[model samples]
Target chain A: MTSLPKHPPAKRLGLAIDLDTCVGCHACATNCKEWNTGGISAPLTDVNAYQAEQRGVWFNRVYTYEVGGEGPDARTVHFPKNCLHCEQPACVTVCPTGASYKRSEDGIVLVDHDKCIGCKLCSWACPYGNREYDEHVGVMKKCTLCVDKIYNQNLPEVDRVPACVAACPAKARHFGDFADPNSTVSKLTRDRGGYDLAPETGYLPTSKYLPPRPGKRSEAMPAAAPAPAIAGAGRFLKWVDRVLTR
Target chain B: MHPAYSVIFFTTASGAGYGLLVLAAIFAISGLMPATAWLGFVTNGLALGLIAGGLLSSTFHLGHPERAWRALTQWRSSWLSREGVLAVATFVPAGLFAIGWVFLGTTTGFFGWMGAAAAVLAVATVISTSMIYASLITIRQWNNGIVPVAYLVLGLMSGAVLLEAVTRLFGVHGSHVDVVAIVLIVVGWLVKLAYWHSADTGLVKTTLATATGLGRFGSVRLLEQPHTEENFLMQEMGFVVARKHARRLRAIAQATLFVVPLAATIASLFVAPMVAMVLALVAVVSLAVGLLTERWLFFAEAKHDCMVYYGR
Candidate 1:
């Protein structure tokens, strides 16, 4: 009973945040909120009325960080966080009821809300702090990787991608089947040397983030003193510059 | 993270059971006992048995209770596995010590001193089992090294009381044991107070902002939950607790587990032996219930990072 057909070696559905390109706009968070609000599985909780405006939603959140760098080299690291969907998700195994189960099918971790008891041990077991409680429904919720959208055939082919992937104005977010080595996401991860956030925690998330490209330097060689001749190449450049400026 | 009542009862009752057995062994080794004393043997055995029974009862929480034996396989990574192993191993010495004390009581010789050595081993074993819970880094409250210290102290106090009762029945001089019991009670109380003080500093877990870096945008908050109902992760891990109720419960625990027990032990020095014994018994029962509350609060009061999504 413990074994399943074609278990994909315990896929950890995690995200690799691009510390480089993230603008901290929270588009991912918003999109995640939108999709998860109507998701099939665990939905986040939004409590309190419009009186003050406190609410809960899950799947994604963006954070800004300041890591050590040089003078101009200093940079802001914006991280979009989600459930690592750990290879050893204590949250799933600790469930008294079999409500929490890491899928062997596509490796998407899920919850059966019907069986939940609101016990709360899985939260303590997670160092990443990804699990969220739904007070309204008295259950737990977390990221599902847009399982509905990714698998739904009714949507247009391009739009089938996760909402975060679709909504990224900067094109910073990328989603695909990371399990396939030939997949765009996998190749991208390899070329960029994408690293797991807190790899030491050993969750081994499925999503990989392409590291920020190091800033490159290309110098303009002093403008060449605008050769007195202005006639040949200089005259042509001057004409182009005048037109571009206008 | 409020612990279920079942778990709270499990740890407290079991701790006392193990703790008392440890004390019984220690007392027998000290040779302070008169020859042919059967009281220590019976008292220690009963305490040890109760601990064993409590552990067995806790297995009911497992979905596949029959597969509980497989839990021992994870000792390499899991403290629970180690705790289970040590719990069983501890009984070996406990039984040996118990039997040795009985023999020494029936006859007199270095057999009594052998009982003391067995007692020392039992003490170490009990401490090890308690540390299994206290050493978990994930559980901020239980992570402190003092958890083991606290368990040992309380165990000693409980054991001391049981010893006091049993020895008094035999009319064996019980003042020395009573004194040790009082010292342990004081020690236990101070440890619990320290634990509470440290725990009170702030949340054991982090917030969504801290967890997800969502706070960078001024004041990031959950606007809506992604799900409509409770899921397994939320049900299993999203336990919420009330601070006001916790405060009330803490007072109750301190009063019963520490205050009453401490007072009763001190008064034992002055009161008639039987009266003193009865008071200690009352104190013991109150302390058990209080500890159960304390254990429940231990989990209840702990906040989880997941509550961030819960809109706590």
Candidate 2:
């Protein structure tokens, strides 16, 4: 069952994240934790909560980085990373048990707690580090893309997207069937040139990240001329005096 | 990458175990070894005991050891599953061969064919074990040709040393086994050194820019980490060893595993039979300690691709 499906699924459910607009607010990560803590992979336990060193399992995380250098070209980019639901998810295929598997129906990678022996091999096989082992449950856990909520018949279709996508304050996260070229997520990817995290690894990740926009160049400021000797001497003497005092 | 002790023991012990079984099969099939009861008891018992012990130890690291049997179900796609299946399958012919040679005093006909089959399975098991790491595309250091070569050669070298020690236990004075052990040790460590060299010079295919999809925006460096403290991924994959310490460990591994073992095997040739047995025993003990350190370093030095996100 861990083997890839013979035919690709008709619906490759995935996300399109706009890296340019992400502010690294961590709202999506928090929302994801809040929802998943009570869902399938429940109680993503934190061992040392409110302590100096806390460790836990989280499905989504936001990382902030400084790009380029100082000047107008310098900019901060926030990347919200999660499971990409790769078409060739090594995490699924490398599983010793059939617990970690990709759904043939929707192409969402998931772990069945019932069958998992918690060998942690799937995590090692994954290039993206999306899967985290839940020590409390003694099983591997990962981003389900809100499978419980998304597929719930009782929930309204509009409210059926992933918790992270719904909670993104900047609306940076988009959820739709990427298998359909006409879907909004697919169009967004096509328009913004959304790319995979590590294409060289050949995972063929379904989740795409829109690259940060180019920075604007600012005019360099002019240097100030040195002051005259007597006044400058007084200023220099004061600076020296301050330095000596410190 | 965490270098869990159980797994280190598992791979090392099982590898040597299978290696010895393969050699035993070859010796029996080639009519090199006489079907003696003591030899059968010592060799078969040690080999199967190591294999069983290693496999059991592997389960200790798993969260749900009770469900470990389920791992064999997905051999179609998983190397771990394939290894499990092959490991179990190997015991069948190996067990039959042991019964025939040790209890019934037979090494021909059914026993000979069974020994041959067991040898093939033993080699296949080692290959399956090596592929478990080699097939992984995430850890650049492990996903290489040298990893499997190192595993295979080291296993054989250790097994050869063990065979020499066993031969010395009796009054046998076969210089060929000692020479074979010495040759295997030299070959094994050379491959290991090559593996280290490759890891040192290899270019990591992915970087922060590519991982984040922000290369066009220019160079990217982490400004803020996702968490204040370590997470599961960080705990499992963020293990790092100091360069100086790694160098020291490598030296120790080389000395005890290769140099000392090879020297002892050679010295055993000139000494009395009693002294030679003692020298062979020393070689086995030293090799175990050295391989333990080497296996630990193997895990410690590996860098996971995911660490790029954390600026590691």
Candidate 3:
């Protein structure tokens, strides 16, 4: 049962994250925790909640990186990471129990907690470190892409999306079927040159990350010359000048 | 790569057990070993005991040890599952062989074939165990051709040393056994040396640039971590051992696992039967300590692909 689906899924539901727009506010991560703790994979337990060494299971995480060298060309890029729902997920195949599985219908990888033995092999198999082991529950958990809410008919249609996508303040996270060429995610991927992370690993991740676009600051503004030093300026005047110049 | 003690014990003990089973089968089939009921009980009991104890110890690290049986269901794709199934299946033939040899005092007819079957299954079980680590592409040190070969050679080497010790207890002299043990020890060390060399010099292609898909922007450096505190991923995969300490441990492993054991085994050959027994036992003890250190290093030195994300 841990074997991969024999046939490709009809739809690949995935996310397209825009590094250009992500603010690294952790809104998506928090929103995901907020929903998933009660949505499907509930009780995302945190160990030592009030202590100095607090840790817990989370489906999404945002990282901040300084790209390029320390120069004018250098830029800070906020990266949000999660499971790619890979086409060739080793995590699923490595499970001794048929707990970790990929859906042949929608290409979404999920963990069935009931069947999981919590041997932690799947965690070792994941290159992206997306799978989280809940010590309290003694099972593996990961990003479900908000499976429960995405297809729910109870809420308004506009609210029917992944909790992370719905909560992103910058509108940086887009979700749709990647298998469809005309879908929003696919179009965004094509137009913005979205790319996979560590493609050499050959997991064939479904989710894509849009590269940060060139900033307009370099093109629009030239370096300004330093203002002339005020000769023998009063202390009060020097403070005002310093504030104005800054 | 945490070097969990349970796993180290499991692999080492079970590997030696299987090796002993294979060697015992071969000796029995060739009429090299005595066909006494006492010898049969001692050899088979010791081998099966080690195998069962190691298998049981492996379950201690699992979060849900009670549900461990479910692991047998996925042998079609999982090496761990295959190992579980094979480990259990081996007991059938091995048990029958033990019963026939110990009670019936005959190993040449039906029981001999059962012993042969058990030997094959035992080797397969060890290979499956090695594949559990070798098949993992995430850890460069484990995903090597040398991993499986080193495992098999070391298992057999340890088993040979133990066999020498046990045979010496009965005042049985087999010069060829000592020669095989010496050769296997030398060959095992050679394989281990190659494994270490490859691990030390191997280049990891995935860097921070490739990990974050930001190579075009130039060098990428982590400015901030995703969480304020260390998470499970960091605690588990981000484990880093000091270079200085690793080098020291490697030296200790080489001395205890190889040099001391080899010296003891060679020294045992020319001594009196009683002295030989003591020396062979010393070799076994040294080898066990050495193997534990080596196994610890195996996990400690491994660098996981996910560590690149944590700036490790």
Candidate 4:
């Protein structure tokens, strides 16, 4: 039965994020929240005063950071984190109510709102912090990869992917079945060298992030410029020095 | 780790309630009763009320209150499951013990032992609850193994302190309370300090190297975020701390939860009961505030595996 259920092509639909190409504008996050809010799947909630600038409702978020590296070549880094929908998801197994579970077919981690008691225990269990509490419905919220729109026949075929992936102007995000070696996402990962968020914690998230490769720099040395101090000395002293050198 | 006020209240209230239940049952077993049926009844009633209140308060943390029953499952691996089961176990025995000892004049040894066992279970459950966070390997501060031991010890200490205060209200033993309360509070201080000392270790992992799983890549850095508007990191592990503020807070917490409390206990032993009592109250308030602050710092101080992207 298990072998029969196995994906011959291994269609585990997930994203391969190219951090190198991402502009860090947060369009993905905004579009995701917007599409998800209006979509038939489910809505993310904004708690407290909606008027205040501190509104919260996003399946994905971008964080700006300055990662210190060895040597003088260190610089800032930006990370947009969400549920990786791991091969072995701790959030799913740790869930007492089975609210959080990974679909064997797509490997997408989702919470069944009806079954979820909003215990927030799953939130604690997840290391990635991808799950958020929708205070409005009192259920856990997470990235669904726009499951509602993806399967909807009413929508255009090009717009079938996640809202976040569709709206990325920088084209940093890719949605495909990485389980298939020939898939676009898988090829991109292999070509660019993809990585996981926190592999040490062992959540084994399915989503992969392609590390930004350091581009090649020219080795040709620039011509040395003359010292400005040479022109600043007293005329008599300069003349004396020149004569002595001669 | 963000020191959710709801969680703080839940752990504190529930732990104290569990401690009170355990203490009262122990008192009954040890024959330290107040020589009146009404007194034992009142003590049991108060303990029971606190416990019920604590359990009720715990539900506030849940997203779905109706699914609370499901928490009883996963006892095999989850400390939370163990805690829930133990909480219920404590409650049933306590209820039976109350009915037997308070209302029924029958010195039912069965009920007595039931209460005693319940007390033991309560302690076990509370410790298990603490371990749920403590055992996690990701969050450096919460990952410490001593968290459970500290929590249980603090529970007993707080219970003893509360007991002393209550007994005083009833015009019961005075000097002996000072002695016991002092001892418990001192133990709490030492355990807390020990916990703080032990939690300093953190699991440092190379971010780019870990991400690549190959030393071939010289270094790794996030050139872009996956999305915008403060995703999960800002929500879950977005801890902020200023060094100056942290140093000041740590000093204040050390004074409040440990030094001040310890000194007060000693003074309570030596000086007038009033001064000692005043200090003890200060210690309680200080410890509560300090521990809460410490909890916040604990979360803030602890670095997550993902934080390497942020250069933390």
Error of 3 at A159 (Å): 1.3
Q: Find the candidate with the highest TM-score and give its number.
A: 3
Judged by whole-model lDDT over C-alpha atoms, candidate 4 comes out at 0.68
Q: What is candidate 4's CAPRI-style docking category based on DockQ?
A: incorrect
Mind listing the fnat for each candidate? Answer: 0.06, 0.89, 0.85, 0.30
Each prediction's DockQ against the real complex: 0.07, 0.67, 0.80, 0.19
The residue-by-residue lDDT of candidate 2 on B1-312, one tens digit each, is 788999999999988898888887777667777788888888888889889999999999898999999999999999999999999999999999999889998877999899999889888888888899889889998899998889988888888988989888966546667777888998998999999999898888988888887777778899999988888998899987534498899999999989999999999889888999999999999989988999888888888899999998
On lDDT, the stronger of 2 and 4 is 2
- Isolated chain A: TM-score per model? 0.79, 0.87, 0.89, 0.80
TM-score of each: 0.64, 0.94, 0.95, 0.77
Q: Which candidate is the best by DockQ?
A: 3
Per-model lDDT = 0.63, 0.88, 0.91, 0.68
The parts of candidate 4 lying over 4 Å away from their true place are: A1-11, A23-27, A46-52, A63-80, A94-96, A153-160, A168-171, A217-246, B61-78, B105-108, B167-183, B206-236, B239-244, B247-312
Clashing pairs in 4: A61-B231, A80-B225, A80-B226, A86-A205, A117-B63, A117-B64, A118-B62, A118-B63, A118-B64, A119-B63
Off by over 4 Å in 2: A217-246, B242-244
lDDT of 1 by residue, A98-162 (tens): 55667886677776666554434455556565766676676667677778888799998888877
Better of 3 and 4 by TM-score: 3
Model 4 Cα shift for residue A69 (angstroms):
7.3
| Model 2 residue B55 lDDT score | 96
lDDT tens digits, residue span B1-312, model 1? 656655666677777786676666565556566545367556766787778777877675543456556545444444555566667666665565566556545322455454555456556655655665554445566667777777777777777766766676677856688778788888888998998887777344455444443333334345444444644435544665546687788999899888887787787789897897687777778777767777777777765444554555
Interface RMSD of 2: 0.8
Candidate 3 residue A217 C-alpha distance from true site, Å: 4.6
